[model samples]
Target: MPDSGGLQSVEASQRPDSQVRVFALPPRDNAAATTIVDGFLEALTSDDPSYAVARKYLTPKAAKDWHPERQTLVLEDGPRPHSTDRANAEETGRNFELTGTQVARLDDEQAFQPDDRRYKGDLHLSLVATGKGKPKQWRIDTPPHGVVLGKTDFQRIYQSVNKYYYAVDSAAGSGAAGAQKRLVADPVFVRKWADPLTETVKEVLAGPTRWLNRVVTTSFPLKAALRDGTRSLAPDDANKLTVPLNKSADSIGAAQCRKMAAQLLYSLRDLSSSSVDEVELERADGRLMCTLKEGAADALVAPRYSEGTEYQYFLDAKSRVVRMPASGGAHPSPEPVAGPMGEGERRMRSLAISRDQERAASVSGDGRALFVASMVTNASLGDAIAHSGAKAEKDGFTTPSWDGQGDVWVADRDPKNRRLLVFGQGQADRMQEVRVDELSDDARIEAVKMSADGARIALLVTENGRTRLEIGRVERDHGVTDGDVEISVADLRRAAPEMEEVTAVSWAGGSRLVVVGRESGGLQQIRYVQCDGSTPTGQALPGLTRVSEIAASDTDLPLLAHSDDGIVRLPAGAAWQAVVKVGTAPVYPG
Candidate 1:
């Protein structure tokens, strides 16, 4: 095949505005100086932490000081190196100007911040010989300070592994011994050397990352290490991991033991079909204490309401909170629920329901105050958990999201304080404002939904003058006497980074979410994506207009959206159906 200018122009025109650089290691038994440099650079692009294969391309000393997490140079295109024929080419070192658009960077603290600038620099390369020989195999002597990778490869190789942590508070009236939720979705580079299951368990035992340390607490004993290190995690014939902990955990109690085992099971839930089906914890003396089975992972940790138990609530023609049945056919009518929020000026601006169907949280008519009221009869409007704390623009709070544990989560889009606030329910609820200083570059939350399991949050953030969808890990810390609370949202990362304007988001299932946004084409549409930032090839919502909001629940309930053509819906296993002629927001318990 030969190249043509006309063909090249057409292919270039079809390329996306955001181009991801490609990184592939070249094949070579022995290394040339250029091959060593190339292989080292390729390994930097990988998600591998220890840089095992990458170290093979480096000298012993250089590999030890190379910190890939120190900084990340996100390039717009692949790196190109220029070779020299100097007498001391392998000793004196070579230099070249590596120029490209640097889109984002990860700091020494491992926080990802978007830069989006044209980066130009002179990068130097130092090389060493394998041994004393004429055609000696060369290796990198001085490695680069930071990693460089294409955006596409970064997304492909870097995966977020969630570690289960106990909820800040437990569900009221539930007698479960230890309830857990997957909290931290720590991103790690996938390499043949690092096993995900082993890494996840080990990381949990090592305790939550620094950013989430203030919020999430682990049941793993302090400084607890796997008995045999990473190699101790081999699953037995029952697809079960018999974890033996170090002597430090010998004094831990039975309840704490089950929570620790639950963390292992839920964290490795996806691997149930292949490597792990259950997690069994052994005492320091090699005595079995508990076994968390695969089928009970979700129920034991992230439990949800059954699909048959309908709690489909929505806003009615009078802008009042009302309940609608999932079995309601095309002409199903809704009844106004009893509460102050349903009556006077307290009429809701936006509303959300807890999973237990015991309470409903709502924004005021003016959206400045947030109130929680009972969903059932003879219940009063609860206290105004938050007052407006805005300094710059329009001041208001979005819909209040209630988790399964009775804690309330909401974001005040105050430009002065783009604070995500959490209130732990009690005789006197305690509140903590999340410190999201650079969330999507100071973006304000327009709409947010807490997943039924209370692990993750789907946020519709207004960033760079456009709406985008992002998922944040829900990390909480609470106290016993006072119900002290603090929530730390994970560092901002877009779920649909390539999409132009994301208007709304809702969790459609445990691991999937339904979002309304557009990439490059027609009207805004609804699509599905994994919580870990992967696109799922599900059927798109057909004949759906631009939606103002989206509402979903724990079961096979209808997918409801508030569009310009009134409240439209897509019923379970059926086509799109219009539910009401007049409604602004549709909601369900949790």
Candidate 2:
């Protein structure tokens, strides 16, 4: 694919050792039809700019007509070639059936669209005459429109990356200074060794992926693009990256330009082995638009998951809300929060702490009532803010969750009255039943975890005895009065379709979640799944038995869970160790 950075052709032998490189060889002299097809397929997976080497194995007409970037077909297994007529050895042409199980497709926009179907395509090859009595060579004249790759090769060639954009002011309430400064992460896969910095920048400029486009806004202008003919982007000796934009951005103001740089700064935060401490935006004519240092960028754009949490809260044996230091040592002492919810007669089932850590919401032990209390003051549990009519606790409310806007969300599991409820900011008494537009009538929500940016929500939905993880976008149509507000979760799509059952899920990062689930006929396991439904290869955590609840933070805090061995935690590069022997519901401030 041609990145806006303008990819340039390079020979395989001349590639340096900076990044993992895939090199493919051209067909051997006078290769057979099958050999030619195999070589062509292998070459498609290599890192050749414009796929020059792969095109050489095709007939002249096919070379001119093929467009590798039009699409990408990812298969469960690599494409298998079956000779259509192996018995006809003397024939001047050959046809092969290429078949595999198609798992997903990448469109021209580079967004992954999940699919499941049997894929069957054709490959046609024929003997092409060489000039002046030279031996004839076999060449492919017909191939699939897009390149085909196995799951393994797809993972090998591409990597998951997050591009940042600002959450709408309406979603995350504006502050006195300005719009709430939270940035949402839009995750996509890009070629790992193909000048990723440039590719990522182009993607950010292109805008958010389809699911996130409506909820997030980019600072770059619609017509903004990399300076013409720019190839690769690398930091200088002092870890500074200079991005030259097209004429479209020539009139951008200093403040807006800094916001653009902030987006780029965090979007490229994980560039492998490179420390980009500073970002400088330059106009097409090389005039500086603005410069943003790492520290200054933080002031412009508050990263969704950059803030460290102080405490991890949960319910103790007494069904009271208690907390321990989020970075508490292995045996950190637990204490009741300073609120009636912790000391009052009313016990709790599940709870959520607001992102700001100022308020707490908890569901009554029977899951019938949801109460809001202040964690900063010793206030009463007060009257329940919401209720579920289900007689049985199991059929009542799932856990309550708080979005970044200080709004609360919970689901009533009562079969006859199943629905999601939202308590809007500054309007707790005006509870609204949020519509789940795409969910099937028979499916019911079992759990929910809202993203800190207040734009998306992770749901554990149950249907026919199986639970699955899905991500839904939170949409609100505001009215002049609080009673006129309409809330709904649109575009509910699976975030982990491979797992047969998802029991618990928590937001682990800006665009990632920690899930407790399992595949069909497999044991329960803890793993990380992207919000876009793509799983990062080799990211399953070490085994833990009977895991029922899981928690994670955007920062470096350890992952905590309620398991058979009681509450346990997994620190970076360490095994799961005991946290508390009696805790039940583990949670970190949202």
Candidate 3:
């Protein structure tokens, strides 16, 4: 990941650490072979394409054979002391012992997979006499075969950024089976200070990363790239950019040209201090082909969560929907939502609201039934839609989650039907079941939240006595299922491998997530993690005494967690406050 000066919505004063260390220079010592091993490992993670700094500690032959890209082992914590054995000059130099808690690995192909376990290894090196008359110098005779980093360093150094790509268009021109072209986020990792505009286009032209290959597309032609000799695409006078395309992008139509602009505009919108409001494409000779405005692109590629008037919604002591000032004002008297679910005996175990906040979904106290209603205060609880068709023994449901497209998802915890189901716009009859058997035969989803942008779903699935966070990409096709448009979820992969037990999760930003979990031998914590399962090295939600349930939205403020102490919120730069002392399960509009 390049250190392009990119933007983040999360403010710094709220986090304990603002940056993480990615690589370090070798700490040289002639007598300590362990120091040589530590320096060698750090150099492998460095951005040097040729692995030069690391080579200073390695023999030329060893450097030539070692491939840093072969694998990246993510260890549990920061550096630790390695035991070294004294050497006798005649035999092998000595052996330095290394140990770690490895939570994940990225193989040679850059494919990331979870490997939650402990590792112990030895580095055999020599403290050899250069010549009979010279003092002996310690040098590494063997180095680890792959890159390895402790989890803390991994989070601090790498941040995930999403670049835009054309939607998997299921429908084409003139009513082709109810299809439309939209934008989907293609997440990539870059260092904390990457140049957003230049790096983004370069990455897009470089094509999708290994994880999302073929699942997305860009309008740029084959072998197309950001033309050379261009210093920057940022406009000096206004919020518009004119980007020069490589010669391969010479042949494109008007629609394709606009699509290209949409890709750029959306990709650049997440910059922390971006002024770019429009994007235009041009031939290498500087002929303008098409232009797109910020407003136009936003309408086409909806936000992960709608940025509406910020309101803090939660379930009061009486299990009713209520709201308070999001940024903390004179506390408004907590009031029930505009519907029957907010009153009556419809006690909610948990609640989820739509991005627009015009509708909501709730589960019963016993978790046996799911309900949905309009946001209007007068909507009757009796009139709320109910999902049918669950097997009698499998009637339990988890908290419902709403997506940008107005779909609500919930899991049926019934052992017989251990499946995830989606309800389109709260229509019970259109319920569609999603198969996730690959997660495990006994895996049952406990909690789930759909991303605001409709890209991924964060789920807490318990299998084989352990619960972990998995990010599931929603799969759709032209085919219909159970009277609803076809939608299934697969590609479930571990994110936050260090947390073996996850209780809750929510989208904190487009490419990031907030989760409630505990690391090995650690207390329960609320931490920020990337959607791809990567996390930034930072403090957990500050000033909260305890949290049982947490709520977050890109639509509203920072974070809210339901605790025994009360419903507390961590407003940026402020201590957690019991915002609404009466609410139990809390949530923001998705």
lDDT (10s digit) by residue, model 1, range 1-590: 76755553345443333224334453265555666666767777654556677777766677787777577766667555555456565455665455567766655534344556877654455555555764445666655667776665555444444455654443443434443453434332222234656766776677655544544567787779887543736788778788888788888877777778877776676332237778888777887767777676556555555354475677777768877776678766777767664553456668887777777787776777888776566677766767776643356888778765677888887766567787765122467777653475466788878776575687888867888877776665445744344556665556766578887888776656788888766567788766655554325666577687887765567888888878777886777777778887687766
Which candidate gets the maximum TM-score versus the true structure?
2
Model 3 residue 275 lDDT score: 72
- Model 3 residue 203 distance off true place after TM-score fit, in angstroms: 2.2
Candidate 2 TM-score, C-alpha based: 0.92
Worst 10 residues of 1 by lDDT: 184-193
True-structure RMSD, every candidate: 6.7, 7.1, 7.5
Q: What are the Cα lDDT values of the candidates? A: 0.66, 0.83, 0.69
Q: In candidate 2, which residue ranges exceed 4 Å CA deviation?
A: 1-20, 86-92, 129-136, 171-177, 303-306, 479-485
User: In candidate 2, what are the lDDT values of residues 27-70, reduced to their tens digit?
Assistant: 88978788888898899778875788999898889989998888
Lowest summed lDDT window (length 10), candidate 2 = 171-180
For candidate 3, write residues 1-590 as lDDT tens digits.
Answer: 67888877966553225443345575454646667777777765555545678867765566677776577777877335475654444445667776887877666544446787887766777665545777766666676777677765555444456677754533224125323444666666543444556766676667665555534567777887767797555755778888888788778877777767877877777654467888888887778788889877666553445466467778888887887766665344666777765674677777888778888788777667788877775666654455434455335788888876677988878766667888766687767787663587767788888875455688888878888888877766555433334676767888887786887787776667788878788878888887666565544565344577888766448587888778777777667766666677778887
